[model samples]
Target: MLNETKDPLPVAERVVGVRLESPLVGAADLIKAQEGRASKAFAMRELPFRDLVNVRGELSDPAFVAAFAGVVGCEPPAAPNTVARSDHYDVLWLGPDEWLVRSLAPVQTGMLEAKLTAVLGDAYAAAVDIGSGNTVVEIEGTRARDVLSRGCPLDLHPRLFKPGQCAQSVYFKASIVLIPTGDDHFEIVVRRSFADYFCRIMVDAAASVAP
Candidate 1:
């Protein structure tokens, strides 16, 4: 049917915005939100069966470096982004004198820690399990960098933070180790005692961003 045609003014589409489920949402929902929306979310989850091994030997010792390389199966003088990984373990260079060895499985962590401590005898180094003292917070989504920048002083631009990067820094007025899990995700390692406080600060900060 032919009607008087008047060009209708363009109407802006009223797109529906997603409502955040809740901070108490399930893991499945959390994963879904991260995949769908470009929202940053942090979950303070209990990470079981992990270990932190620190090498205490002098950095200048050639024999020590060779022995470490033998066990780690990688060069001691590591270049940037140099990470040695076994099936269940990963060795990350923290500095010229320090490095962090971590593992997911308890047996794997125990075996590796014992092996390294034994291999690198009293004269070589020490390996202590400090896993009990820390808490792990998994953060994900596109806004992850901005959420972290509120508390951290480091430049988190992707160009500076490549994958597998970890650094010790001030997080919400507490010291923590920030590990990049992906391009838009990170795992924040904080002390166990300060976990509750850390979570509270993160919750408040996230609310502002999410709103």
Candidate 2:
């Protein structure tokens, strides 16, 4: 007689109907408090719930590159401090062998990471969903650069740091991935742990530069 056996893998849990909060839950209130103190030429807001995946692999490996391209719809940026973008995602070069994949829109958590991991199977690579660990903050308008320059040490001159470029730098005490989205617009990807402090410091900086 043969005995019945249960499946070894456990079933994935489905969570639903839960309310979600962004890392900077109080950002709106903080911005409102600044009111006229903050510059009219500057604005700051959190782009919460974005999907972020940290991918690591050798770009020289054709198989690894192909696998990533097949899943992400574009080859990872080969140039240092550049970004490779597609309709759905933007791949930012973090290091010689590391890239941060950010979704243009909100996606089911871990969906992209799972697809990447599945396709990159047995290839020297790794895909980790870091969405929950980070949040995006957008600072724009005429005085945006001034606010950033107050604490960030990078050269904010347009001739030097143009669009489609990114760099890992520190904003005051918080480490951030800075991306120039337009002439006067920049996005900062910072850790959830530092979101509050980042907003407070940024607000203070904006107020300092107010006209």
Candidate 3:
């Protein structure tokens, strides 16, 4: 009899049986506690499972710019501390040649990275799916900026840090990518490891300043 062999299942198939949880899965009660004060001053909540892709390329190259814009619906913001927004994505400037592309809506893991890679074919660029590496926390209300100002050193005055702008900064001990989505609203992109600490600390800060 001929020897028989079988091909192993793909990594994706093998992992299909796994269950995923948000980094802030353990902070449900903490978040609920803050919800009571949400209507008054500020509220904090985790926006989990967002599709985050880190893209890097030289914008000076015509091919790179074209390829990126083709896929992202806009050229990467060349200006420091700015964000390029599309109907489906918000491209936040992380460096002169690096950006974080965040989907406006959640998507199947790897779906965004695959689309970006396909469109940027052979270009001197990279698209990495870092969705599982971090989580987004939204803090909004009348006192949202006040709560952030407690730990963040940036001057959040409207004339200084308005909507459509982003900065890499720290919230107390956690390194965060801060985005101003509106006058009194902000989104913080923090590493998964720090999600718990960041949320707990933020809630405490908000309570101290609660009206």
TM-scores for all candidates: the values are 0.68, 0.89, 0.91
Q: Rate the local accuracy (lDDT) of all candidates.
A: 0.62, 0.87, 0.88
Per-residue error (Å), model 2, residue 85 = 0.3
Q: Of models 2 and 3, which has the larger TM-score?
A: 3
Pick by TM-score: which candidate is best?
Answer: 3
List model 2 lDDT by residue over 41-74, tens digit each: 8888778888899999998899999999998999
- Candidate 3: regions farther than 4 A off: 1-8, 15-17
Q: Once all C-alphas are superposed, what RMSD does model 3 give against the true structure? A: 4.9
- Model 1: residues with Cα > 4 Å off, grouped in runs: 1-46, 58-62, 69-83, 105-111
Q: Measured by TM-score, how close is model 1 to the native structure?
A: 0.68
Q: Of the candidates numbered 1 and 2, which has the greater lDDT value?
A: 2
When superposed on Cα atoms, how far off is each prediction in RMSD?
19.3, 6.1, 4.9
Off by over 4 Å in 2: 1-14, 32-40
Alpha-carbon error at 198 in model 1, in Å? Answer: 1.8
